[model samples]
Target: MNIYSWNVNGIRAIQKKGFVEWVLKEDPDILCVQETKAQIEQLEEKLTQIDGYKSYFFSAEKKGYSGVAVYTKIEPLNIRNMDIKEFDFEGRYMELEYKDFNLINCYFPNSQSEGKRLDYKLRFNTAIMKRCNELVDLGKNIILCGDLNVAHREIDLTNPKKNEKNPGYLPEERDWMTKFLECGYIDTFRYLQPEETKYSWWSYRFKSREKNIGWRIDYHIVNESFVNNIEDAVILNDVMGSDHCPVVLRVSVE
Candidate 1:
């Protein structure tokens, strides 16, 4: 099965730029998107009725800010909104439970300019990690994907040395990822291609994408039990609609 994840920045904006056509062409078994930035009522029927897929959307209580969505060829056995008051109100997390596994599509909180939101982002990281562990203890395999809003290693972003103080690459944020991996979550792309220097998200300023100066903040992280099932994990750098491109993970699931 093929699953894809992307942070579209703004769903309506991307839709007008041929996102719907691109989705039909790629035809992933499941597609998860972050930063939808719009309520369900604001979406046109074309996006809501994308041929063969059944789409689910979660919009933030504060309209047009932060939201997430999942489009799947197979209807989920169950769908869950994480409902943690501090996190859920922003519409950042959603879960689709199949018979054998659970898929989580998340848009982690970003530490905004001047580190104003750093504390909130850190709290979010801690809470989600706790939730992941709980799911694992329940004997559920998890495939977690979306824009984590972090660049976990020196190799993850261009000029990491120069961006050390930046929100995405800060020492504390990177350590959380290290701890998460140590606790049995595998970073799919890094596990599949350890030495590749590819990125998913680029800055709109400074002609970053043109120069390939970008950060691999988006990811498909799976539980250790699902590692062997992963056929390949890739960064689709050429596929562009937002500052962030799409990340695809292929697996041998039934």
Candidate 2:
């Protein structure tokens, strides 16, 4: 199966940039989007009628804020807006259960400028991790993908020294990722292309994207039990709808 994740920045904006056309061309079995930044009512009517997929959207109560949506060729057996306490307000997670596994589309909190929201982000991460572990315990193979908003390692960004104290690069945020990995999740892209210095997110500041100075903050992480079934994981750095490019993963399943 071909599963893809992209932080569209804003669904409306990307629609104007030919997102629909791109979706048809890629033809993924499932596509998960984050940071939609629009309510369902505000979305164009055409968006609800994509040709071959069943689309599910979850928007924040607050207008024009964080949101996530998932479109799949195979309709989920069940779809749920995760009820994790303290983390539901932002509309950051959507969980879908297929016949064999669970797919989670996440838009993790960005700590924001001046480290102002770090505490909230940390707490949010902890809650989600707990929820994910519960699903793992249920014997469901999980595919958790999103813009996690952390650079993860020195190789994940262009200039590690300069970004050492930055919000997403901070030790606390990076360590949270370490904890996730320790809990039996595999960072699929890194597992497939360990030495490549590729990236998925670029700053709009100072022509960062044109210069290829970016960070690999987005990911496709799966439970370790499914690691051998992963066929390929990649960053579509050449895509141009948003500052963040799409990450794709292919898995084999009988």
Candidate 3:
């Protein structure tokens, strides 16, 4: 199955940029979306009603803020808005449970440029890791995808030396990622292409995208048990709409 994830920035804004048309063209078996920034009720019918997919959305209580959605060609056996009340308020987490495994779409909290939200972002990383571990303990294979909001290594960002103190590249955040991965989740892209230096999110300033000075914050992470099932992991750098691009994971579950 081909599963893709993108942080669309704003669902409404991207819809105007032909997001629906793009979806139809790519036609992933499942498309997990993050940063939707709109409630289902606020969306126009055309935005919600793509022809061949079942769409599910979770919106933040705050209007035009953080949110997520999933458009799947295969209907899931069950879909859940995560039960973590603290983090769920922002609509940052959702999961689709299928016959073989669970696919989690998450939009991790960004540690603001000023570092004011750094603590919160770290807590979120810890919490989400715990949640994933719980599922793994139950023997459920997982595919976790979204903008994780951190650059775990020097290779993940364009200029690691300059970004060392940056919120997304802070030592603490990177360490947290190390701990998380040690818990048996594989960074699919790195697993497939360890020396690759591509990125997923680019700064909207200084012609960052054009120069390709970006960070690999978005990911398609899979539980170690399913690592052998992944056929390919890729960054769709050519696509545009959000500051982030889509990361695709092709896996064999059948």
Give me the candidate number with maximum TM-score. 1
Q: Which pairs clash in model 1?
A: none
Q: How many pairs in model 3 have backbone atoms within 3 A of each other, for residues 3 or more apart or on separate chains, i.e. clashes?
A: 0
Off by over 4 Å in 3: none
On the 0 to 100 scale, the lDDT of residue 99 in model 3 is: 88
Assess every candidate by TM-score: 0.98, 0.98, 0.98
Write down the RMSD of all candidates, one decimal each: 0.8, 0.9, 0.9
Candidate closer to the true structure by TM-score (higher is better), 1 or 2: 1
Cα TM-score of candidate 1: 0.98
Candidate 2 local lDDT, 1-254, one digit each (tens): 99999999999999999999999999999999999999898988788668999899999888899899998999999988778656667899999998767999999998987779999999888977887899999998899999999999999999999998898999899999999999999999899999899999999999999999999999999999989889999899999999999999999887
Q: Model 1, 87-144: lDDT tens per residue? A: 8999999999987689999999988867789899999888888888999999999999
Candidate models: Cα lDDT each: 0.94, 0.92, 0.92
Model 3 clash pairs are none
lDDT of 3 by residue, 23-85 (tens): 999999999999999989999999888999999999999999999999998999998877878
Q: If both were scored by TM-score, which would come out higher, candidate 1 or candidate 3? A: 1
**Number of backbone collisions per candidate, in order?**
0, 0, 0
Worst 10 residues of 1 by lDDT: 109-118
